[model samples]
Target: MSSEVWFTVLVLLVGVERLAELVVSKRNAAWSFERGGVETGLGHFPAMVVLHTGLLVGALAEVWLLRPEPPSVLAWSMLALVVASQALRWWCIATLGPRWNTRVIVVPGLAPVAAGPYRWLSHPNYVAVVVEGVALPLVGGAWFTAIVFTLLNAALLRVRIRVENQALAGLAA
Candidate 1:
């Protein structure tokens, strides 16, 4: 199969994975909401959805429109990084369990989760997002998409992190 075809297949697979994550996140959010959890960082949620959607659209556009032929070594390396990022992303999800909704809702008296990826980095899922944002686009020679999304995500995360920290503090107090 051509790289373009392979890239399309990869995109479809990613979409399915993301759909599954959304399902899980919805259930987690419901659980948290039932326990009187307060969601913070609402502002970032819509932007995140747009950014993720853009990643898919931008990647396909690059492959089908620009058709840039990246070096095979670089393409394969990026493909590996994308796969690795997915692994880490899911690891963060599994580690957080029901506490891992897409929204930042803090359950009172639960004690901030410190297991798995949380042991080292405070926000390992964001790390996964950063890696995958760049790696996925690079696999398809979508440099513009990668750069744009990375910068946008950085800006969004600055506010998101503050919101999350404030929510956690409220829970602590």
Candidate 2:
């Protein structure tokens, strides 16, 4: 298969995975609400969705429009990074379990998780996101998409983490 074809398949799988995340997020959100969870970062959520969707669209556009030459070594390396980030992303999800909604809703009376990937980094999922944001596009030689998404994502995460911290502080109080 051509590199473009491979990229298309990868992006499609990512879309499917995201749909599955929504299903999980919805269920988790409901569970949190039942326990009096309060969500922060509501304002940033829409922008995050748009930026992520743009990752997919921008990747495809870059591949088709730019027609960047495939470098076997670099593309394969980035592909490996993408796969690694996905694994870590899922680990973050599994570790969070019923508390793993896409929204930053902190359940009262519960301490922040200190297991799995959370043991080391407070926002491991964001790390995976930033990793995949850059890696996924470059895997298909979509450098423009990778660079643009990385910049936008960095800005988004800054606000996201701050909001999450505030929500968690509420849990502490």
Candidate 3:
């Protein structure tokens, strides 16, 4: 009935979606490994997991603790961004297919995919990540979580993108 309750429901839904992604990612990772896929960037994987989990937890914590009542207009706009980010994220997954595991695993001798959202952006999923990092929390008026997640995610993405580029380069070679 309340906006906070709705926000909690939304966050729980997102968490469920993330679990579904993990299921797909695990299956895809297995597919890649079977195909001689080489995984890089293991080092940051733990940090990424923690930070992402923190994003959800922190949003809830901040909202319940701080109790900021974001205006309806702002909340609606941020919700739109969150939905858009999810769409883009799923687009990336579909385009990459079995190649879309969360880890940076690249199969040798395969060509780089330039289709779907990848046609325009080298890391479109990261675009979704960045947007959602900020927007999701703000939807709950969790500004602190939004700012902290954005900053931390930026640092993590810097390492992630570099590792991914190198892995992709191996495919090219």
- In candidate 2, stretches whose alpha carbon ends up further than 4 angstroms from where it belongs are none
Better of 1 and 3 by lDDT: 3
Q: Give per-residue CA lDDT, model 3, range 1-173, as digits (tens).
A: 87788999999999999999999999999999999989999999999999999999999989888889999999999999999999999999999999998889999989999999999999999999999999999998999999999999999999999999988988888
Model 1 residue 78 lDDT? 93
Q: For candidate 2, lDDT tens digit of each residue in 68-88? A: 976899899998999999899
- What's the residue-level lDDT of 73 in candidate 3? 92
What TM-score do all the candidates reach, one by one? 0.96, 0.97, 0.99
Tens digits of per-residue lDDT, candidate 1, 1-173, equal 98888998998898899999999999999999898888878778899899899999899888889888989998999999999999999999999899897788888878887889899998888898899999998898889999999999899889888888888887668
- Model 1: how far residue 132 lies from native, Å: 0.3
- The number of residue pairs in model 3 that clash at the backbone is 0
Which residue pairs collide in model 2, if any? none
